[model samples]
Every structure is written in C-alpha cells, then in structure tokens.
Target: MKLIGIILLFVTSMQAQNFELRVQAKTVIPGKKIYLEYITDLGKVIKIDSAVPSAQHTVNFKGQVKDQGAFYLLNFFDTPKPQKVLVILEGGEFIDIVADGVNDEDGKGNFTMKGDYPNVKYMLELMAISKEMETKVRKWNQEIQLDQKQEKRIQAEFTQAQTASTAKIKALIPQMGSHLVALWATNFLPAEKEMTSLVEIADRLGKARPAHPQVRQFVANLQRLQGVNEGALAPEINLATPEGPTLALSSLRGKYVLIDFWASWCGPCRRENPNVVKTYAAYKDKGFEIFGVSLDQNREAWLKAIESDKLVWKHVSDLQYWNSAGAQAYQVNSIPQTFLVDPAGRIIAKGLRGTALDQYLAKLFESK
Candidate 1:
C-alpha cells in the first residue's frame, strides 16, 4: 500500500506542469511539417518544435509550460503561404485543433480550437476578434488615395471601425473576470487613453498569475506608462549634443519643451520637420523650447538632417540607434514621437503632430 501511494504521487507530479496539443489536418500533404513557435518579449519568434503528421493525419506535441500567458503559434508550413493559428497554453491543458486543409478564396483560415481550459477558449476568441479587426483596417486603407476628400472619408471609416472594435473588446472583458484574456483585451485599446482600465486588469491578473513572466512584463510596462502619462513627471534624459557636450533635460526647466524623438532615416520625421519648424518659429520666443533626440547610428547623416531641416533647436543623441539611451528612457518605439512638457516639466501630452501640435500650442499660449 505504501509503494502504491508513492507511485501515484510520482504519476501526478509528472503530469502537473505538462500540456498536450493535438492537431487534425483535413488534407495532409507529404513532406510538410508543422511547427510550434512562440514569440519572445522582444518580438522575435522562436520555433520550439516540429512534427510530421502521422498516416492518420494527426500530429501531437507535448511539453511543460514554463509560464502562463505566453502565446504560441501553430504553423502549417507547407502551404503557399503558411497557415497559422494563435493559441495560449497553460499547464495541464489538453488542446485539440481542427484545420481545414485549404484556405478560402480570401485566404481566411477555416479552423477551430477546442480545449477544456476556459482561458484557452477565451484567448482564442480574442485572437479571432483582433485578426478580424486588422483585416478590416487593412482592406479599408488599401482602397484609393486620390483626393483629400476621399482620404477624409476613408479615415472616418477607419475611425468608426476602430471605435466599434474597441467597444466589442471592452464588452468581453467583464465576462473574462480575472482571466488573462481581460488583460489581453486592454491591449486592443490605446494604452494612454485606457491606463486606468489597464491598471485594474493588471491588478486582477497579478492575483491570478503572479508568477507568470508575461504578467510580470505587463506590470513593468504599466509602471513605465505611469511615469510617462499625462500629469506624470517626464523621465529625465541626459545625452551628448551635436557639438560634443552633454545636456540634461532637467536643465531646460521653467520652459515649455517638446521632446522630439526622431532619426535621419525616418521619412516621416523628415516630412514633419517643416511643421515642427513652423511651430518652433511661432513659439520659440514664448518661453517654448524643442529638445530633439535623434536615434541615429550614423553621426554624419544626423548632422546633415538637422542642418537641412533648418532646425534651430537643442539636438542630442547617444547615436545608439534604437538603443539610444534617451529613446529607451521614454519608451520610444517609433520615430517622430513627441512629448509635450509644460513649464513645470510635467508631461502635458504625447504623440502630437501637425495641426494637433499647433492647436495645442495655440490654446496654451493664448494668454501670453
């Protein structure tokens, strides 16, 4: 009896952190392999394992999950374009996927996922909604780009679609409760506009999956967001200027500052420079300043862009490219990103461009 008890305990421990994923393909071609892949925090996709379907047209993958909230991609690599499905696998899950061998005329996938785990079901559903939204937006943008009126109409349509998609995703969050799907749903919304909801979901997910790597990462991102959000103190940045002297953002205190993150290779940044120049010309004497931070690897190109744009501003860079110290300090993932700081050095707004920047500055300097 004692030995039998020990054996049962061992069996239970063996299966505790493991998951089994089985796929049934309707039309399995010879020599084609299926891959199980996961993306890293840095957005690099790593292929973990691959398997060939058996004579019965089924393939199985089994592994122990390191952590929950990690999204995995199942890819059928033999197709003209690989057919892929996104799935979430917590430990101790048995997930089955049915794949239709042929994609539709529009290349839409005909697949269904079944799992006893409620989170898996919810995550898959959320992924479906996200994919649908992306498809709709892409199709709308791919139309004609002839006239300004037509462009305005297309943008309005895009805005309507985005509003409806956000509403749909938000409506599903309450039903998800403390599940990670609720946290994932918040990602579909703008992070700056929905920080309160994001923080709440992060709190709930922290209680449920405290040890998960993804949860930890999400919490860290929320902390960073808090530091950069409106009314929050802007993170400090100190980098070398074009003339070889170090300048600190704190030194520019008592003035309204625009922290512009750009690079010479960025086409949009070059195009937007004229508008920025215009805004600067209007406000430079009104206690307004521009602190340009370049994420350029080449020093020559950076200097040439600054000169060519007629940008008479305090420009600084570590010239580390995307790994620029200042860019990372402010969580800048794209070029031509700007943060507006008031005289008190608090972040007033972010990502302002063109007419938006002009309108904001106009209202701000109306009194002076």
Candidate 2:
C-alpha cells in the first residue's frame, strides 16, 4: 500500500508540471493559404497546422521538461520561407517587439508574464520609457498643429524626450545592456543619423563588455555600418550575376556610384525607382552609375522590377531577401536606401530623394 501511494503521488506531480501552448491565427485575405511553421534547434522545421476556411486555426504543443531555450513561431502565407511572428516559450513576463511593417522586419507585439528571468524587469522598465516617449511625442505633435512657434517648441521637446530615452538606455546598459544596446544601436541611432555619436557609444560598450556575445556582435555590426557611412570608403562587393558572369564592385571604381539597396516586392522602392531613373540619367554622363543590390528571394520578380523601372544599370543579388550576402555586408535593414559614392569610391551622401537627389547631383556635376 505504501509503494502504491508513492507511485500515485509521482504521477500527479508529472501531470501538474506539464506545459502547453496553443496558437490561433486569422488570415487577412480569404483563400490565401496560411500555415504555422515551428522552427526548432538544429534548423529543423515542424509544420504546426493549416488554416481552415473559417479564417482561424490553432496549433498545440506540449513543452518538454528538459528542453530549455527559445522557440519561434513563423507565419507562412504562400511563401517558402516563413516570417517570424511570436518568440514564444521564452521565460519572460513580457516581450516587447516592434511589430511588422513598423521600422522592423519582425512584427511588434508584447507578451506579458511568460518567463522567469530576472532581466525581465529591465525590459518592463524600457517598455514604460517607450510608452512615455510615445505620449510625449503625441503631445508635441499636437502642439506643432497650433502655430509655427509651437512647432519649434515641440521639436525641442521631442529632442528632449529622445535624449531622456537615450539616457535611460545608457543607464540600463550595465545590466541588460547587450540586447538593448544591439536593438537600439542597430535601429535608432542610424535612423537619427547620429553616426559619430553611435560609433563612440558602440566602441565604449564593446570595451566594457568584451565577453558579452550580443554586445560584441553589435559592436562588429556597427563598426561595419559606420565604415560605409558618409566620407568612409565603400566596402567591396563581389558577386556572380545570373548569367554566370563574375562581377566586382571595385571594377566600377573611378566613377560616381549609387549603391541602391532595394527589394523586388518593396512598394516604397518600386515607387522610388522613377526618381532613381531621373537621377541616374541626369548624372550618368558625369561618370555616375548605379549598382542595385536587391533583397529579393525570387529571380522573376527581381528581373520584372528592373525591366519595369527601365533601370539600365548593373544589378546583383543572391536572391535572398534580408539574408543576402550584400545586405549583411552593407548592414541594410531597410529598403529604398541608397548610398552616393564619390568617384574615389567613398560614400558622400545617403537616402537622397526627389529634389534632394537632383540638387545634390547638380552640385556634384557643377563642382566637377
């Protein structure tokens, strides 16, 4: 009787300790087949389930007691490769993601109370700061609507909020600094065009946490990005074209080159191609050229965009969106971004658009 009681107790404990997860998704378009792909360790992909005609479906999984690591949920919509959605099963109370189509490749959403990690407190605090900053920004925008004087005042306030947020991030650097710094340093600082300041911050962080993996990676990525910034020598690129011909970026030396980072399906990039065409045509005679590096996984779409845009320039891509070798080399996180390199192969301008591109090129030609 004693042995039987002990066995029953063990069985009850096992049942209570089991963990489970369920995912439900609704596709935006009807008849568009949607599925969930669960990526596991060692690059294995486990298909969860397919959406039914009702627009919603679910997938369930039981957590293993011995397995301890992060699991990601990817959304597939008629694409071979999956887009990452939820970073589920991580031990955290809340996870703040920047969302899809909002300045990041991964969709932004927050998970509350999902983990037991101590560093989660820092994440929560950062989320609070982000919320506060959003509120301030909204208020400032409202003031900007009032008057010209109010607009200037609001700009100052916005800058102050940004500064405060930066400070908060700096203070949190010592504890949960690695991931935080990487996220911010990669996304924010460059967008703000604070390259010099970002370099200093990255360098300092790199030295302070020499052994930290994320910090080291961030430092390396930032350094590479900074090397391609304005007034820095452009990084060399050597890739094979679809026609089995080898080409090198250095071969285009002694001419002004506009290194255009774009994707085939990128709407913004497609819209901006007309301006690029105008700029290229106006400046090509003045030794200007464009080397388009497409972040496109499909060769057909890539060629279609180039031909449709009447883009008569050198095009190169490994046909890997986001994971292209050139994308990694250039640290291109966003599309429709162009680097204007001088005749000496040094970057002189970036993100030039419309009249800005025209004016800058006019000046460059006039100087020549």
Candidate 3:
C-alpha cells in the first residue's frame, strides 16, 4: 500500500511543493550565472536550475520540491574561482543565503544558510566539527611519524582528542532525530561502540522518510549494525585456528568472550595487543576469554604476531585477509573491531579498547 501511494504521488506530481532560494553574496558578480545542482547516486552532477545575479549582487531562484528533500550544490559556475555551498532543499522552504563569496578553507562552505533549514544547518555543523577533528588527527599522525621521542605523548593526546570528538559527535547525532543529517553524523561514530545508537537512528529515519532515496540507502547500509546491536545474539563465527583445527565462538558461551577482529598487518591492532594481553591476563581466571579472529592472509605473519605479542588466547583465521568469513559475518570493514558477548551469547558492548576496556572489565569482574 505504501509503495502504491508513493507511485501514485509520483504519477500525479501532487507531492511537489514550491520553494524559493534567495542569495545575498558580495562575491557573486552582477550579471554572472550561478547553478543549483544535485549529484546522482552514481556521483554525476545534474544541474537543475540557474540564476543570474542582478546589479544588487543578489540572486533569487524559485523551484518545486517533493516531500523527500534533496541535497543541492549552489555553485558560482561562471566565476574565475568556482565554489559551491551545499543546501538541503526541502519542500515549502524559503531559504536565504548570506555570503561574502570567499571559499571556506575547509572546503565545507562559507555561506550561512537562514530560514527553516534544520537539516542544512545540522549537516554543515557536523561537517565543520568532522573537518576540525580530521585536521587535528592528521597533525598528530604527522608528529608521531616525524618525532619518535614523543610517540607516547602524541598517542595519548591523539586518543584524548578522538574520545572527546566521538563523545561530542554522538551527543549531536540525537539532536538530528530522524533527519537525513543524522545519517551524515553517523559516519563519525565507531560502529562497534555506537551500534545501538546507530540502529535506533536508522529505525527512526527508516520510518519517518521511508520513501527518501538517501534515507533508504542509509538504513539499508546499516543492516549489519542491526544484527550485532547491543542485546542481539552474537553471530556464530566458526573458523580454523592457528594450529589448523576448527573452533567456534559458541564454544566459549559459558563465559564472557570478546570476539576480536584484527589483522597482523594492522599497525593500530598490533600496538593495542599489549593492552589486550594485560586485560586477558587479569581476567582469564574470572571467566573472561577472548576469541581472536585474524584477518591476515599470511600464515607465518599471523603466527609470528600472536607469539611475539604473547597472545595466548584461542585465535582463528581463514588467512583470507579481509575476505574471511568471520569478517563478513560481523561486517568488520575496519580492523580492531570487537564484540563483547555474555555467557548467553548476546552482545553486551563493542569496540572497547585501552583503559576503557580495562575499566569496564574491572567493573564486571573485580566485584565478583
């Protein structure tokens, strides 16, 4: 019935609502043309409208939109240095833009959008914070590579910044509610740590804007998160161990087990081995166990890393790199992903690392 309604709406073109875009930019030369464009799923840009600025350096564009909003690029196409500002065009909106025409250093946007444009406002805010965090991470990474003497200090600072940024991003995502802008913010969250939140947002947006193309795409993309969301049953992972015998994640169901997805070649994973080893040693006798799933293709490298890192826990791998069945089942696109499962085989937490992992384990086992 929903599909039929959407088809009928498309056929009748009755869902379309009028919109007006008013721009005030000192940089837009009078008599120059600016374009409003949207990118297709295949990434091809399609120009939908154009406006010529009057002698007052202002341009006005009128259009119609469907209930499902579109993300558009407002480009100064005829300028010497063409630049674009992204706008979310929801139906029935009268959007106003104010700009000096100077390009944003971060390449996000220099223009400030006004009027009832919550999605646009939130999307731009998220982009700004994301860019700021990325710049800090890049600087820290460069310093770590250049100066060996301060690696620990740099790493601590990096971790602190990452944790803070992740917290801030998470706090902001809920404010977006079911807006498509929430989809943009979800990219900043670590899937393992925030799977529950991601799934909730997906469910909400899926219902709120089921017919929206981007919303449908985002909800579909997060299907993996839904499977392993907190309290969901941990997916079974049966693979060959390092010594060649088959083992299953279910075998450790009588205790707290962490499904550790890592690769021998992963630098961050290798560096994090010591913390895992420490955590394992501290809680192994208290019914805590780890099931390490290696995404390494090289047999010798995998064995060497396990031995060198003193990882004495049960470890398995198909030696198929990222194509390992375990990785595919858990949707582990990035290395060092983990799932903490209870004795009942339900996932409790994920992406725990460093001191956070230790603190959590202490809370769980120390009292017992």
lDDT of 2 by residue, 250-285 (tens): 899999888888887875587568768878888888
Q: By descending lDDT, how would the candidates be arranged?
A: 1, 3, 2
Model 1: per-residue lDDT, tens digit, 197-270? 77878898878878877777677767776678789888899999999999999899999999999988776587
Give the Cα lDDT of each candidate: 0.79, 0.62, 0.78
TM-score against native, each model: 0.63, 0.60, 0.53
How many clashes in each structure? 0, 9, 0
The alpha-carbon deviation from the true structure for residue 240 of candidate 1, after best TM-score superposition, in angstroms, is 13
- Candidate 3: segments with Cα more than 4 A from true spot: 1-16, 29-32, 41-44, 78-82, 100-109, 138-146, 224-368
Q: What's the C-alpha lDDT at position 95 in model 1?
A: 90
Candidate 1 vs candidate 3: which has greater lDDT? Answer: 1
In model 1, what is the error at residue 157, expressed in angstroms?
Answer: 4.5
Say which candidate scores most in TM-score: 1
Tell me how candidate 2 scores on lDDT: 0.62
Q: Clashing residue pairs, candidate 3? A: none
